[model samples]
Target: MGRIAVIGAGMGAMAAAARLAVAGHRVVVYERAATYGGAVRRFERDGFTFDTGPGLLPLPAVYRDLFVKTGKEPLEACVELVQVDPSSRHVFAEGTEVDLPNASRAGVVTALDEALGAGAGARWGDFLVRAREAWDRTRRPLLEEPLWPNWSVLAEREPYPSVPHKKLLRTRRATTLAEVGAWELRDPRLTALLESHALAHGLDPRVAPASAAVLPYMEHAFGTWYVRGGIRELARAVYERCVARRVEFVFGAEVTGIVEKDGRATGVELADGEVADADFVVAGVAPGALDTLVPGTALRGGDEIAPQRGAPSRLTVLLALRGGRPEGVAHRTVVHAADRTEELDRLFGERPGFSSSPTVTVSRPDDPALAPGAEHEAVTLSVTVPSGLSVSEADVEGVLGVAERAIPGLRDRLLWHEVRTPADFAEETAADGGAVPAPALAAADGGLLHASNTTRMPGLFVVGGWAHPGGGLPHAGMSGALVSGLIVEGPQFRGSQ
Candidate 1:
């Protein structure tokens, strides 16, 4: 059994370490922060708790699989999941409300037809079927495999490798959702609605792949679920599982360098100059930060390996409000501006900042543990902003103003508010530029967006949001699982070495 060093105490690193430990490897997780769950952590102030990152917990099956692989059941440790009805409530500029239900495709289509117009539901049904096919084709092959630097090995040896490689390259060069939606849906509102969901992943629908339309299909098929407590409870549960697995966790141990010998990583040197030796190293941090840890050798030819840029970071505002629940609003709400297209273009193309109409998601309604009382509510308002926008005190007030307009009685009911900009995310999570990595397939050159596979150094592997399968809690966890599985299979058998 080999000793392994996993960098970053995020969900990916924890999951990888747990799996590696179960495989008989001695695993040590070195985290820069004082706690676990890098981005999935929470903060408390004045008796109110706010999740620092990732508010929603979709794809519970993924977590269940991870727990089961480690001889634990997720439900045994965490609260049962409750599916949110009216999966999402979208408020358009014309005051038209689209309440998406968590139901079958036919039922959803019927709801859309009733909510929108004649024939609209049928078109959505056709679109969903196509999306489902794309999802089915790509889910296992591409998403389950590690985005390795050496593709030739898999192409020549692995099962169904050619299909996945072709699918990824095709997806890399596919048209954006905006273009496809324009062709499929006659109603601009419907088109925007479809594209908006894609944008939630920090991708611009105009440039994101058409396959992203699969997101809706998955949400409806699997149903949008929320943990009984806040999403942070899931992270805490995972952390607990790590402890139970006998995985060594060294918090506040920021990795400064990846020690190398004969061009192979042997261990990691902490920011405080302490060295922890191991046979393998797995990084859960962003690819951009690799240069700091491993220097030039770490990202050698990285630019060519995965030539994609990251998506814009976000300006997320968490509001603790004091008021009764608003009528006509569901657990999740997305308020679109009168000129959403122009607003998005301006946000992404020009100055990156919050718009007049930003997307807002209100969760934890059924779960009273998050708010602590029935009279109080917690709402998270998220907007795609520039990669590194700074938030001043004035920005907080401005955001609250926008939130008030989007949701009635919002400003008057506020108990307090906390604002987190891209800069805040960087400081809190150590993610470079506060960017949430996504698939960088927007370029005509077929490069990915945020997903990178630049690992060239021996004994070193990159996993999680910054690498393949892109960002998203489930995909990041799967990335780690894929890497662990590869490591278990023997690096000599894998071409990534």
Candidate 2:
């Protein structure tokens, strides 16, 4: 059996460790932190708990498959995967609110029409149909399989087939997501709704390709998920599964560098002046961390160009409420900002920083586990703020001001609150500039993705949100699958069939 060493106890790393152990490899995971789960963390105090990362999970099938492939117990048995109904409530700047039903296109369209105005639903529905085309065209290359050697073809060609629209007596086609919103949706609220999906994933609709339609399409098609007792339970479950499969873990073990001999990775050197040799190494971390492990290792693909810089990390606020969470409230509510253009510019343009009225996503789960008693409630507010910038009380106040519209009496109801910024993320996860990797997309001449799972150094593979198929929970899991496939199945390995 090959001795496999995985760095960082992140989802992708652990996912690979579990599958590798199941494949009869002697796997050992070295985590810098005391706990597992990279971005998915839970904060608890006085019986109040809040998910610090990724309030909801989209495309759970990725984890479901991981459980099915590695063990007898299905994902359902490991944790309660609840499908959030009326999936999300969106409150726009114009005071228009729409409660979209989960995985129901007809219902979503109907709700949008009722709230946003006539024809809005039809326009969105049509866009989704077209988004499906993009999803179908790029799914195998983007998610299900490893990037092919001819990835240039995927990069050069845009999968989304934008329809020609006659504007001012001239035929025009959309190249970016913003054009899609303006050309078809034709309404301010509709445009806001469409762009919000992209912003939530740290992508700029103005620059993100039309193929980004797949973002909303994926959510609408598969549905969003929540894990009972917070997402940390998921991390616990995955860690347990790895243990069950005979994988060993050493917490508080930070890897300082990767040892190399004969131009191949031989093992890793720890921060404590110790080295552990292994036959294969799987790294699941931000690009900065990967660079530190291997001093001169450039994570480049076929062209060997410089790696694309990842997007900024998220800013989250954990709120402990004085009153109980009322029933009939949507589990997730998006408080859309009044000025999306300004916000997007600040986030993605030359002026990268905080927004005075940035869009906020508020998650108020009715689950009893989050509070000490029914009389108390726990709430979380998240915004897609820029990474590497210092966030002030004013910035946090800006998020709260928008969120108050959704929460109603949010200021008084907030018994206590704590804000976690990108700086904190850098401390916790070691991502450069606290930048969170955006999910891989099909756009921008290939800036949408990280380097391939396989690196220049033989016996070393990279896996994480910063790697192939890109970020987000599902993408992270898929990265693990790809890495494991390459190691277990050899160079001839294609992705999962």
Candidate 3:
């Protein structure tokens, strides 16, 4: 049995540790923070609980598979996973509102048509059909398997099969997400609805590849899910599963360096200067932090995809309301921006800053555990913003204003509000400028692809959001599976059967 040392107790790292332990490897996790679950954190005050990251989970099969592979208990037995019907309500700039049903294409199409116009639903349904094509084309290489050596094939080819548009005398296909929205959807509201998926990932739709269509398709196909208490509960279940499998966790023990001998990673150097040797090492950290661990060694080859940086981060506002959450309210609502051009420019512009009226997502869960009783409610408002910005009073106020569209009398009902910014993310995950990583895409000349899971040095591998398949709850879980497969079954291991 090989001894494995994992750096970080994040979701992906913990998932890998649990599987490796079941495979008969002695695995140890070292985390800098006092607890596990890097970005999946919970804040509690006066009986009010809020999930500071990722309110909803998409493609829960990833975790279900994790639990099945590592332990006897299934994921459903460990945590209460509920499918949120009327999955999301969209509040457009022009006051048009639509509540899309969970995992029902026909229902979503009908609702969009009824709210927007006669033909709106048809356009969206057709777009989803095309989006499904994109999802099927890239699903294997992007999520199920390790990033290929000739990943340039994915970069060079656009799998999205965009409809041909005749502009003047020439025929053209949409390359960027913006083009797809404008040419295919052909409605301002529909365009905004499609782009919102891209923006939610901190990506500028105008520049994001057409393959980004998979984002909305994945949610529409698999449905949106919520844990009974908060997303942090999912993290808790995974951590406990790891412990059940004999995976050792050392919290508050920061790994400062990677010990190498004869040009191979042998162990890790903790902040206290103690070295724990292992047969293999897996690093689940941001690209910048990973670089600091191995001072001078170039982790990626010149021809390999470079590590992604400067991605935008999220600004979340947790509101404690005095009123009970009304029955029959949608679990999530997205308030689109008033001006798309200005919002995009400010977020991805030369001088990056907050939008005066930013697109905000308001999540109001109908769980009694989140509040003191039936008398109070906990609401979370999140917006994608440029990374490394200081959160000001006005910024917080603007977010509240955007949220007011979803929750009437938001200011009056607000008992107390807390702002969680990129700064908090930086402290928790060691990501530079608190930049959140987006999932890898199949096009845009490979601009959206992440670094390979395997490093240049033998016996060293990367896992987590910054690695192959990239970010989001499901993708991170898949990364863990891929890394464990590579180590347990040797490098020839392709993916889960």
Q: What TM-score does structure 1 among the candidates reach?
A: 0.89
TM-score, cand. 2 = 0.98
How many clashes in each structure? 4, 1, 0
Q: Pairing residues by index, what is the TM-score of model 3?
A: 0.99
After TM-score superposition, what is the CA distance of residue 383 in candidate 3 from its true location, in Å?
Answer: 0.7
User: Which regions of candidate 1 are displaced past 4 Å?
Assistant: 148-174, 300-304, 307-309, 326-329, 392-398, 439-445, 449-454, 491-497
What does candidate 3's lDDT look like per residue over 1-497, in tens digits?
99999999988899889999999999999999999998999999989999998999999999999999988999999999999988999999999899999999999989998999899899989989999999999999999998898999999999998999999999999999999999999999999999999999989999999999999999999999999999999999999999999999999998999988998999999999999999999999999999999867445657888878779999999999998998888999999999999999999999999899999999999899999989899999999989998989999999899899999998999899888999998888899988999999998888999988888878899999999989999988999999999999887988876
Model 2 over residues 371-424: C-alpha lDDT tens digits? Answer: 999999899999997888898988888888888988889899888888999988
| Residue range 452-481, candidate 1, lDDT tens digits | 333678788877777666677887777778
Q: Which pairs in model 3 have colliding backbones? A: none
Q: Evaluate model 2: give its lDDT.
A: 0.87
Better of 1 and 3 by lDDT: 3
Number of the top TM-score candidate: 3
Residue pairs with clashing backbones, model 1: 438-450, 439-449, 440-448, 440-449
